[model samples]
Target: MLAYRHLFHAGNFADVFKHALLTRLLIALGKKDKPFFYLDTHAGIGRYDLNHEWAQKLAEHRDGIARLWERTDIPGPLEPYMACVRAENAGGRLRWYPGSPRIARAFLRPGDRAELTELNRDDANALGKLFDGDRQVHVHLMDGYQALKAFLPPKERRGLVLIDSSFDRAREFARLTDALATAHRRWASGVYALWYPLMDGTAMHAFERGVVATGIRRILKLELSVLPEGWNESLRGCGLLLVNPPYGLEDEARKMLPWLWRTLSEERTGGTEVRWVVPE
Candidate 1:
């Protein structure tokens, strides 16, 4: 599990989908006057240099952020996400990409807070250094699941939690389902976002069933696939399960994901879906 470095896939299609949606979540929180906390489990190095050897090896950004870097027709909701990327790479060249922590930090207001947890030593240390002088942010070098238990029901009592785990370990789907259900029980009001890669049909079905059985309502499921289900490529697509999602998130995603699929999909064989797994 430690072998999986997000730097290798920093600006890949999946990151585009996840980060775009993340921006919306934070924006929604800001709509309310009350302060909110943002938690990033599996927080990678706060930022990524796409020119780095690992990132350049695959040049995933060429298929991800590079597609949107200079686009003038970006949908309204995606403007914020692209702005974050542009901010990272000044001088009109795509050289850097912001991870979840960095994107969340951009939207943090005077009273807003953020917590980032990463089990990987190097990534944790980098994240620590990235937010060293910031008082509104805290970085924890610990297991994301453990951090969930320790930080739930945040004193603010309102915020978003993103569980963007690296699914390098076996049975990660089941583990995520259990953790989500437990977290919902502890803080039903908190917004929870869980990211997972699209994989085997049987496993995905079981994972869906587990979430349904949790008795948690208002769950929204959003997926974007850049390749056919039969494609044997590394990652055909990915999805995010949002528990207690904001009111306008589905509308925003509907407008945003299709454009992403069109821009990032190679063969145009993939698609997007935004629906409620459990309605309010």
Candidate 2:
């Protein structure tokens, strides 16, 4: 299960969908003066080199971040996320891409704190080195699901928890639902963002029902699929379920996701979705 390496898929459309929304959540947290905590479950290396052999094999970024790297019509809400990406590729070349940990770190105020967990030893080491001597960020070499139990109800009590599981194992959707319920029971008020790929209709519907069955309110579901329906060659889409999402996030997604779909989707067959899976 520890074999899931995000480097190969870094900056893909899924990352674009997840991280763009992630920045909004972080920005919403920063709007308050109180310091917040950020816990990244399944945190990979803080940054990725797209030119690496692993990444070059797929060259997925060409279809993802590369599409937006030099766009003249970048949406207003996406500026912060793009700013973080631009900061990493300061040489004006699209050589590097920031993962969720690095993206989250960019928005962390001096008073805020972040805890990142990675099960892969090598990735953990790299992640550790990425934030070495940074007093505000903490990296742990542990299973992300376990980190949820260990770090819930953070001392700050006001923050975001990102559950970006790799879904390499079977029954992962079930595990995510159960974990979200348990975490919500422990920290009902905390913001939670869970990311997942767009699988077949049967699995997707089942996952939706499982989450709704949890009875957690204020759940916002956002999805983007660049490929048309019935095209199952590869991962053509992804979604994020936000529990207790920050105010206006739904509205922001309503505006932002469509633009993303339009810009990223070449076929424009599959589109975007922004709705409440469970209301407050």
Estimated TM-score per prediction?
0.98, 0.98
lDDT, candidate 2, at 12: 89
RMSD values for the candidates in order, in angstroms, are 0.9, 0.9
The reply for model 1, stretches above 4 Å from the true place, is none
- Model 2 C-alpha lDDT per residue in residues 205-271, reported as the tens digit of each score: 9999999999899998999999977779988899999999998898999989999998889677789
Residue pairs clashing in model 1 are none
lDDT of 2 at 50: 97
Q: How much lDDT does each candidate structure score?
A: 0.92, 0.93
